[model samples]
Target chain A: MEIVIVSLLNGLVYGMLLFMLASGLTLIFSMMGVLNFAHASVWMLGAYFAYEVSRFIGFLPALIIAPLLCAAVGAAIEVWGLRRVHHNGHVAELLFTFGLVFIIQRSVQMIWGMLPMPYRVPAALDFPLFTIYGANFPAYRGFMLFISALMLLAIWLMLKKTRIGLIIQGALTHPNMVSSLGHNVPLVFTTVFAGGCGLAGLAGVIGGNYLVTESSMADAMGPIVFVVVVFGGLGSLGGCFIASILMGMIQTFAVVIDASIGDVLKPIGIALSSETLLGEILTVPMARIGPLLPYLLMVFILLFRPRGLMGTRDT
Target chain B: MSTTLRAGAMPAPRSSLVGPIFRIFLIFALCMALPWLFYNYTTGRHSGFMLTMFSQMGMMAIFALSYNMLMGQAGLLSFGHAVFFGLGGYFCIHLLTAAGGGSLPVPLEILPLIAGLCSMLVAIVFGYMATRQRATAFAMITMGIGELVATAAVMFHAFFGGEGGVSSDRMIDRSLFGLTYSQGVQVYYLIVAWSFISILAMLYLTTTPLGRMANACRDNYERAQFMGYDPKFVRFIQFALSGLFAGIAGGLSAITYEIVTFDSVSGALSANALLMVFIGGTNAFGGPILGAVLITLMQSGVSLISNSWLVYVGVLFIGMVTFAPAGLAGLIAMHSPLQQAGRLKPLIVPYIRIVVPGLVTLIGFVGVVELLSFKTIGAAQGKKLVLFGNPIDATTAQPWLIVTGMFLLGGLWLWREGRWFHTLWEAMMADLKPKKGAAQ
Candidate 1:
């Protein structure tokens, strides 16, 4: 019971964080029709920025300032970098962002050194919030959850209630129409791009401390964020959220499930040794393949439902 | 010259092959003589480094060309191309090991072919799934497949050999022409021979009906569909054929290095292939060849100086994407119009003006990069900041002030001068309009 409850909570926390990152990517991808390959790197920059800002000021101020700075960088990238290559084609845009991943990651290294930064949870939120069967759940997690929930609410209110939000909604579903319908499409694109990057920054500020604030963190998170975006389907934030939580839960649960195909086959009187490829496949534990699940899910989704679960447009 | 006008098109078929065939032969001759040239003239002896670098350039050239088959011909932006290359290397090494153990009797000459076939096999399976979609969906699927294979390589130790990867001796029992594959020169020649064959084969493929159809699909998918060509089939075949060449490159890498690591199939290498293809200019056939060699030299040269060379590569890649989407080849090809109009000499003054400011801006950027990189890494290593053998203090405000000032001022000046250069270029181009009209 304790294992189940704790895993569930941990999975939720991870799911929320994944959603924060993936939501931005999905927004940019849906609106701009180019996968921002440097999205995760921007999130990394957010964490680095927060680290620097928090060092100079406090954690609260860093939390606000870092995301804004990320937004500004996102604006610059969209306006200066992406706009020039827009005429060249989508491939050029993707390559541009892909190159940015290397530049941003190395720049982070150049500034912060090769080692992980010492970004920590605030002292105010460092203590345990609750215990499930003697396992402590930190107060910092509650803080993370609150921030994510607040962002979600803000995103929902902005998209569904406000005028700019409605335009954003139109852009999400009927992007061509949004451009054709006398809207400031370029402005909308820049805003969406910046806002998405800001959300990723917020995730970084929170997740940097939750996980290890390392140089490699971007690479580790990049593919998974892609998996979430693709699996949830393009142009669907609801699907993005669903896919993230589902992936989070699956990963969280798979780590503890020690069963293999061999174990399943054992009851069927089909014993397999570790001599052959098939045997090895059968004998390998689920925990070992936990990291591969998102990719597998992404592949399966792309194969069966190219539009994704809740997508209106085909990716 | 006419081909340069249609820059973002398929490789131009030569009406008469006499000149091109002669050039091809000459290029191959150069490749064959390169090892000896380096051995006797420059180094006074065989330099393993030169041989290795040459061999690497050959393989990467093949890899980049294969990548261009998908990106340039089929319009498929695949992020997982190195899967074939890396897997091809792994298979070739295994083949080499088998030959060493007296089981496989195939000569070293045929191993690359076998590896290419093996790589094509994987490409066929993955291509089936990937080619099911086009554009972004296709790219995503490839990315997934690549990530899957990469993860599996680390997960299963059966074929991929886990983290330590697999290694084999290049000095296998069997050799061609009764000569043992012991010397670096021998291996280098073997790679060169294969590289020539692969290049010729790919060049021939560009003139084929399938290649033309692939280009047609790239330009207009619906039109190709109307013309009764299945776009997916074209992409699949192109992907597979490209995989064959990629695999052959991987085989060459295996023979040269005699070891394959998980890094071989990593996303980084995949990105490296993309960088090479794009930097060379995807439109022209020889573009990737230029990219492959330039990148190989840069990799060998720049890596010795700084661990942060990837940042430079990244910046270069992004810069190319933004400023020169057609690549270095494209920039050279762009000069054909000026040369044709006999107006090349007129733009010299404007070009010099732009070039001077560009150099200043570049130097400033380099200074900033050095200072920043030195502040972190150089200090960590307890090494003093040195530029052109002059000891410098990174902590000093003077260098920082000069670098920032130069960067900002030079950048502004360059922008203004660049606009003026563009105006002069336009005027030069306009001068051709009336001459062409009168000729018509």
Candidate 2:
């Protein structure tokens, strides 16, 4: 029971982190019709920036300033890089970003070296925030939760209240109508691109410390974020949120359940050995197959629901 | 729309046999002769570098052409193409090892065929799932499937041999001739022969009824359906055939390297396929061939000189995507319009003007990149800044001033020269208009 509670909590936190990354990707993909292959690289940049800034000042200021810097970089990429390739097509745009991934990854290695940085949680948030079922939840996790919630509220409020946000909302559904109505669609694209990159940077700021500030962290986290966006469906933040939590729960819970399908089958009057492929597949423990869950979910979703669970657009 | 974009203009419908037949013989002679020329002249005994590079070119030639069958001819952008290539290699290695163990009595000459068949089977299963969707969804699904196989290759110890991978002996006793396949040159010949065969087969495929239908489906699936054809089926078959050729390439790789790893089937190689196809120019049948050769050359040559090879490739790819989607072949073919009108002489001065400034700009840009890389990366690694065989300090202001000055002046000059080049090109195009109209 304690394990279940702890896993749920961990899952929620991880899901929120996944949400932070996936939200930006989904927003950019839906509005622009181009999947930014360098989105995770931008997330990685956030972590590196925060680490650098934190060394000079503190984590607090780093968190605030790192995303702004990311925004600036994103603006340049959109205005100078993506705008030039805009005439070609979406495939060209995707390829351009794909190229950016290699450049960013190599550049990151060149700048930071191949070693992981020593970015850590602040001393103030290092202790336990509370005890839940004999488990101590760290204050840093509480802080992460607070920040994500604040971001969620902020995004929701902005979309509901602001003129630009309303325009973005309109573009999300009826891009042609929005364009025909005399709104500067290109400007919107640049703004959205920058804003999305800023969100990714924000994710990197916290996620880097929570995980590890390493060059390899981007590659590791990139696919999972993609899986989340695909599973949640594009053009639906609510769906993205739900998918993120579900995936997080599935991953965390899968790691704990060590019993194999053989054990489960033994109780149901079926005796199966690990001699055959099916039996072997069934015999593998849940813990061993934990990493495969997200991919399995993605394939299943793609085969059944091409548009995803709540997606208004097809991938 | 998809099918028509590729098949609307099929070059010329008359006298195809005479023209292609002559070209094929010429290509065949060139393919057979280049190796001997290189063997006698360049890097012949230079620590097996040239031999290895030649063999890589052969395998990549086959690989890139197969990739073009999808992107260029069929308009299917796959991100997991290396799956077949890698699997074919693994299967070949396993067969070779088994042959060495005396259990399998198969001859070494037919090893690639067996591998190709196996890969084709695998492609049939995977392609069924991948070809169901089109465009972005298709690319993403292939990515997912690719990651799945890559993960499994590491996890399952049954056939994959885990992280260590599997190795095989290549000097098999089973050969068509009485010669022992021990020397690197012998393997090179084998690769050359197979590459030629695969190229011929793929080219023949492009001229077939299925190939035409595949082009139709690529350009306009609706029109294909109206003509009583299934787009999905055409894609599936084409995908399977592509896998067959890719399998042959992988088999050659296995023969050359004598080992197969998960890296063979990784996303990086798949990206290489995309890069080779896109950068070589997908509009031409020989685009990926050019891309494969140039990329292989760059892989061998540029990588030896600089560590920032990926940055160069990335920049090139993005530049190609933005400015020249048709790739190197398109840039070359851009002159065809001028050639047909007999007005090529007028553009000579304009070309020279651009080339001079272009060279200057390249030198300046390359200098800045090398200097920055040296300061940040080389310094930490205790490597000296070496350019033109001379050691220099990167922190010096004189070098920085020269670099900036050259870059700024060259850039400005190039811009002005570019305007002139454009004006000349536009005038040339205008001059050719009357001729084109008269011919039509």
| Model 1 spans > 4 angstroms off | B1-18, B40-44
Clashing pairs in 1: none
Give the TM-score of each candidate: 0.96, 0.94
User: What would the per-residue lDDT of candidate 2 be over residues B90-159, giving only the tens digit for each residue?
Assistant: 9999999988788989878789889999999999998888788777777777788777877767765567
Query: In model 2, which residue pairs have backbone atoms overlapping below 3 Å?
Result: B1-B219, B2-B218, B2-B219, B2-B220, B3-B218, B3-B219, B3-B220, B4-B219, B4-B220
DockQ (model 1, Cα): 0.79
A189-248, model 1: which lDDT tens digit per residue?
999999999999999999999998999999999999999998898888999999999988
| Candidate with maximal lDDT | 1
Off by over 4 Å in 2: A262-284, B1-21, B38-47
Estimate candidate 2's alpha-carbon lDDT, on a 0 to 1 scale: 0.86
Task: Pick out the ten consecutive residues of candidate 1 chain A with the lowest summed lDDT.
Answer: A273-282
Q: Which ten residues in a row have the lowest lDDT in candidate 2 chain B?
A: B5-14
* Number of the top-ranking candidate, with TM-score as the measure: 1
- Looking at model 1 chain B, report the run of 10 residues with the lowest lDDT sum: B1-10
